[model samples]
Target: MTEAVASDGNHGSGPLEYGERRLLHLQAARKLLTEGEPIRAVARHLVAAGGTLEPWAVAALREAAAEAVALSAEPEAREFLHTARQGTDSPAVAAELTDLDWWIRPAAAVGALTELARTDGLPSPATAVLVRRLAWHGRIEEASELLAARPDPGIDGAVTDAWLSRLYPGAFGARTGAPALDEVAATHPWLRADADPGAVLQGLALHRGALEPLQMSLLALDGAGTLDTEAGWFADLLAAARRSSSRVAEALLIAARARVELRRGELRTAEESAETALCLLTPASWGVLIGMPLATVLESLTEQGRHAEVPDRLRATLPQAISRTPYGLIYLRARGQHFLATGRSRAALGEFLAAGEIQRSWGADHPGLSPWMLDAARAHLALGEPAAARELAGRQLRGPGGDRPRIRAGALRILAGTVGPGRRPESLREAITLAERSGDRLELARCLAELGRAFTEAGQPEYAYAPLQRAWRIATDSGAGLLLAELAAGGLGGPPVDPAEARGLAQLSDAERRVAELAAQGYKNREIARRLFLTASTVEQHLTRIYRKLGVRRRSALAAIPGLVPAADVPRPGRPRPLCARPGMV
Candidate 1:
């Protein structure tokens, strides 16, 4: 019987006791194989009864792992053999798991296979399965080396797969698309004889926020979706990037930022841009560089009230960032805010407290303390602990190093919201002034909106309207469509039927009518989009037509239409609306 030394991990029947080495060997071999670990490692690590590794142990690992690996059904696990192998012993297994899928996060799987490559023997199907699984998760570097010893990240999957198969017939590893578009961009300059470069400039003119001509051209090319087939040509360009070792990372990062802006209505661009950045940059580098724009997407989704999808990806992006940079508690706290924005108030609070723990872990003078403290206070406040939040806000504002301008305004804004009417109007006004002066448009927008809510709660609807309107304009002009849509639903200051009616049938489609009816009932475009799953812009375009057809210029005109809730009673943030109350409740 093989002597298994004490193992730390549970393989099903508790931690394998060193005394029960035979059972331990069986458990370890089965578990390791099931998880895509190579048989050789399982063999090498196994200890015999006399505490010696043996050939039988190695054979046992191989036989067990092969059996289990063959039985798996997950695309990552089931196709493990075929996904990584160009030629396989089992044709049946090869027939299962090949296709382009958004499900796999390629890099993660690649990192795993890189460790499995140092096996003590010739590559086995088990090892190949491990490698393919790594590539499936976008770990191109490891998969490239293990699979064919080189990866052309710029090319489409078919081209790279074919190239790898030719070079290393038996060991052809990752069968996924090479996703490093920045390197592709650097290698392949955006010049085409048939495509007019000048027309690129013309395309940018329609977008108000876009200013960079080069970026505009890139976005236009992507927007047109005409260049995807040309992905193969990018292979040569990526090879050049490897040879020159150029830093196109910044460009790729910007591409992601620009994609977030340009793709406005799609979540895939966020992943696309980040994947591109990940291919070129280390985890920490891309995490720090990509965090804000990613945060913006997270924030936008949260404001849109699409909480279901916001937390996971955004939260996953944080650990790398917090670990690598001395990002003073602010970014970490901002991360928590990202959670809250997604409607996970409790999680947001916990994240803030965690940041404070990190601050203590890194020591107080670390520049991140300010951000951590501010975030913690904000989180506590958001969780409805007004007194605790108020205390933290006061301390954060007056404490050592003092408050950063934007943070101070944020703290003031929270204080105003929780401090009740008589004591808060001044704080709300002060917060608005501070936010305006700092030019933190993100916080500024929130403060302005919250100010409106503070007044609304205080029985001052007229005062509330100005700030709400100001926030609404800021949201709209800045392409903060989520915030703009939220404000537009606030049915304030009028009776149903006081607003205008439709005149011409020409402007409204049946879909647009349904959309407008829902929109008029105080649903933001996000809610409408969710109910419809069409892009928010599609919903917006229909509404644009609705205004024209109904002869109602803005949401205000539509709100006055009969049947939806009265305008004044509509809930905005801080107002909370009335719980399950009829739409007309004050």
Candidate 2:
């Protein structure tokens, strides 16, 4: 029977009974382990069976557990480690188990690993875990020290070094200006100015073919960037991440995708993806990496004018370690944006400046990274300090990452705001060109709005109409409620309202009347949909019918009739009627 099992495990390919097949698979797993071959398939099978390991299979089980750890099959790794421990007592197996536990429950595993380091000296895997955890907790100096004391000289060591490099660029060594295979820049095309993005993505796909799932995820996290041009590559990676058994990898990929979607002005999708990413892991398990998803969620919410939800989201305290990494800068910027949106310019300026200070101290103050300078400039402008705002904007335009189209466009827009009408149009036009190239609809709309305002200020209302109309369309399509409100506030006009249409409000159903009231108050279709618990398409249909019944050609016309306002809040005679109220105010 033993001989038959061995033969079948190695070479047999015919149909067999279920019991026989199990025996053959176990035999095959043992054979592969003895030969030191890849153990992922074997480990997966054993993990799924949830059976007691025979004493003879103990060594193979240990090997399988280590392989599972490498693959980031967290539950399988734990199961194998637990079962193997029940069969035998080995320090190596114990260390491997501790290392695996670090990924699942870092806070609990920290004490065990610290004890191990004191007594037995840290092993390679344990050392890697400690270094990474230390860095994640914002103990960069200590992480660097520990790494320097015990160099891994292995894959774990390489990954650790790459992570540390991102946290503090020159901590390991001076950059060679050439991409290292293990470095994040090698996988991220945007980080490499000289490489062709398409070629880099293709190379990354080929390179990842032999990597384990966890390694693939780590590389993807390191390479995360705007996906405007490499969206196809991003999609392929996201799909692979979703198919993988590593939950952490899938979460990281989803979080990265959320950021890309946010940049593309897909606010609802961005919020959904970020929330999904957060749900995949516990807050403790996320470590410092929580900043990515958290910041993305906050920014998306702020842009969509969901201010009521923002307070709830911010109620959770972030890990102190996040304050020391690049992720911290992003979080600070997002928080500042929220403050700005809520009219707290002083608080917003403080957050933006603090983020900039941290980045400057880290020598990572590149506008492409966070653009906090431009944010500060906007805050200064809101505080009525044009000179201060212009100075900051000028510095951003002359700074290291100024050439990036997105950053440049933002600076140009703020600079335009500070200048006279003679120079405002030129700067805004350039900003529009840069924004268009960057493929950021939010930025494009902002530049167009500014251009329209500049034209209005110059007494060219005719010229203002085209840009304002274009800006409004972009804002509506992108669900940018804040921008929509701003455009409405700036006097986006419609065709002359026919006095005969004033009675159309009485011809509407309650549902249509409710939708029309919100629309008249400058709510975007998406906002109205959410308020009415309906789809945006449904809201659009209602608006279409309302327009026909009211004999109006534009949304602005809806506000022209006093009857659209609720009777309790209708404006009295001789008071200049407000055309639209900002979101949340209504």
Candidate 3:
């Protein structure tokens, strides 16, 4: 009898031991195969075992050799498949060989398998391979029908079902379309034996030349709060897909690019990417697909207080969210934000509550993504309910994602607003630190503005000057007009123009303007000299020129001008560095 090895992995029986010489020949064949020996040479060594080896063992070697040839070219795969079919009538062996070719040369494998099935009715194994090939090409209906037509009570059937569940979770009675991974793992025990959904989808995309499933999987991973924003793997995969020149692949990649850019705080670039993706995808066929990009656009616009520019169709799509999906939560949250920006606190709170309920039910309310807790808190705070706002923010702070810098910054911002004077500064300062670390320009600017306001409210305008100066710089660079207005309202700064006496202020040179701004901030001549990295005599000379231009001799008179701060001052070594030069905002 020939020696048999387990082809079904750990689910099956152990390997059957062979005679010493038979084992040596099998080992030699494997060694030759690994060393890049020609498939024909490796096949000869394995075939020389003849009756000494098990039939299954020979089938295994033949399948491995077929896979090796499939890697070189499609013609070689066809040649190997034809040779194998001529020698064996076993459906199991044919199915195994077909699967190997399915990854590398799927069209040829499918054609040969279809012909074989037509000539002689396919057994469960061969039928399974055919089913996967159909599904891989997006023939979901046909694959479903084929799988339903063939039912086996053996391990082959179980394995087939497991694979279908992994590739298309919807096909196996599991909830699909952004179902949480934990939910899928709990419901579909068969999938527990396979790799993660993202990995499985990636493997299918690479092997079967089916990029759509992987595209959807990327979106699903993002929605499920499982995507690793820091990983370059997804980017590389998208680049590979783009190289294939598949429009759907490029569209999916464009949408994913918008998301990545948004996470990195490149809001304008993100919006552009989103808009490009929206143009590529069909409206009717990709209505659900447009939700994420629309939300990204809304976020960018709302942050910049350009709410009037949001399109009518995008606003109309918000309330039609699919329940229990991540897209639903995102849409609702975005809608609530729109309401908040438009000063409709009650309406915003209603949308937030609905989103919160969905997130709570799913147990996937991560702050890094949905952040409904912060959304609700901001709404309540706007509604003059400090206690409620504090409670909501506190819950988020205690959650798993609280340690994430963005989440921490948001929670701290809310706390800063709610707390008493003594504790407020500490919270706001910590929030600013976290925001800076996260590299979110807008968030850091907001925190700094808030901190400056808090200081001014506490009768400490001198301490408020630095943060407001920094905040003004960031907000101006990022085109955060609303934040600039807020800073202006708090007696800090505005759009780089003096609220009073605009023309004389315009007369000052850039260096004199720097001296005037420092003087206005109450820096003494020597202190201004130190900050500006100039000698006291040069500082005095600049100040004299600034005073002549402003027609004000006293130091306190220069403190009142806006839009005149120059970059001549370097921050002291212990303080956070000044903002880097970024391209002008769109």
TM-score of 2: 0.69
Score candidate 3 by TM-score against the native.
0.56
Distance from true location, Cα of 412 in model 1, Å: 0.9
lDDT of 1 by residue, 418-496 (tens): 7676677788788878776655565677777777767777786667766766675555445444455445555423321
Q: After superposition, how far is residue 102 of candidate 1 from its true place, in Å?
A: 28
The sequence of per-residue lDDT tens digits that candidate 3 reaches over residues 1-586 is 1222223222332353345444655666676666777656555445544422345445545564555442433344444444555556766556655665554334345565555444346776567566655654445566566655665423434544555554443335322233444444464332453546567444443322344355446665654335553557666666664444223455566776677666555666676777666565443323344566667767766656666665453545322324434555556677778788788998999988887776666545545557878888999999999999999999889986788888889999998889875568899989989887776678888898888778778887667777877888876665555566566666654533432456687788888877887788778999989998999999988887877777777877666555544422211112121232322100
Question: Which 10 consecutive residues of model 1 have the lowest summed lDDT?
Answer: 95-104
Tell me the tens digit of each residue's lDDT in model 2 across 160-262.
Answer: 5655666554445422332364364544333443544434443443111222223323333333334432567666766655554445556666777777788
Ranking by lDDT: 2, 3, 1
Per-prediction backbone clash count = 20, 0, 5
Quickly count the clashes in candidate 3.
5
Kindly report which residue stretches of model 2 are placed more than 4 angstroms away from their true locations once superposed. 3-59, 66-77, 83-91, 102-119, 137-145, 148-159, 168-225, 228-232, 493-586
Q: In the order shown, what is each candidate's alpha-carbon RMSD?
A: 21.3, 11.4, 13.5
Q: Please, what is the TM-score per model?
A: 0.40, 0.69, 0.56
Best by TM-score: 2
Q: How many residue pairs clash in model 1?
A: 20
